[model samples]
Target: MARKEFQHYEAVSAAVPGDGAYSAAIAVKGLGAGGAPTFHRVLQDQTFKTALAADQAAVQELERLIDVTSEGELMFAQD
Candidate 1:
């Protein structure tokens, strides 16, 4: 049987000094094995004008990283 897993993401604006453009901080939380949730920084200080845009970019990045195709197929990466 396949083990069940859960993931959650959050994006927030992180503006830096002298940089006119806005950046985003993306955080991910994973749950598995009925254990404590694990936290990770997927993306940090990524360029985005707004929180909504940053969120969209973060999702796209995650999809690409996980090899999710445009046709909605999920592919696992080979080691």
Candidate 2:
């Protein structure tokens, strides 16, 4: 997993098991009191042949993230 910290939250890259492959995902966690953690499934239309590839893609996606909502939602820089 790859982790990135923002002003009020943190983003993590993850690889999830898919059909004969791996899928990229992002997990966002809010910082400070009353914060929550949210898992966001990314790259739904793509699958990687290896977990490492998926994780790497996820890390790239995490880097693209601009911010996190108070509700633990993710805001990406682009679609």
Candidate 3:
């Protein structure tokens, strides 16, 4: 049995199209056959300053969902 190497790109975003506010998985990849991949936050540059739940359970749940390494990146989107 042989296993194949696969490269996949997945992103989740939410916003009213043409609203000038959007968030997407904009992967910054280097051009050419072999390239490096990087992630960036596009648009939606708004000041998000607000207190959140002190409960650690909720925080942990969010961390589990998104592979977050930094703090204070509280992200939430609609259904």
> Number of the top candidate by TM-score?
2
RMSD of each: 10.1, 2.6, 13.6
Give the lDDT of residue 19 in candidate 2. 78
Lowest summed lDDT window (length 10), candidate 3? 1-10
Best by lDDT: 2
lDDT of 1 by residue, 1-79 (tens): 0122223322222222225554432333232234432322334545666656655654554443443233323333344
- Best-to-worst order by lDDT is 2, 1, 3
* lDDT, candidate 2, 1-79, per-residue tens: 8888888887889888867998899977665646555668798899999989999999998888888877778888865
Off by over 4 Å in 1: 1-21, 32-46, 67-79
Off by over 4 Å in 3: 1-22, 33-36, 45-79
The deviation in Å at residue 78 for candidate 2 is 3.1
Candidate 2 Cα deviation (angstroms), residue 51: 0.7
lDDT of 3 by residue, 30-75 (tens): 2243554443443434312221211222233233333322331323
By TM-score, the better pick of 1 and 3 is 1
C-alpha positional error of residue 74 in candidate 2 after TM-score superposition, expressed in Å? 1.0
| Candidate 2 TM-score to native | 0.79
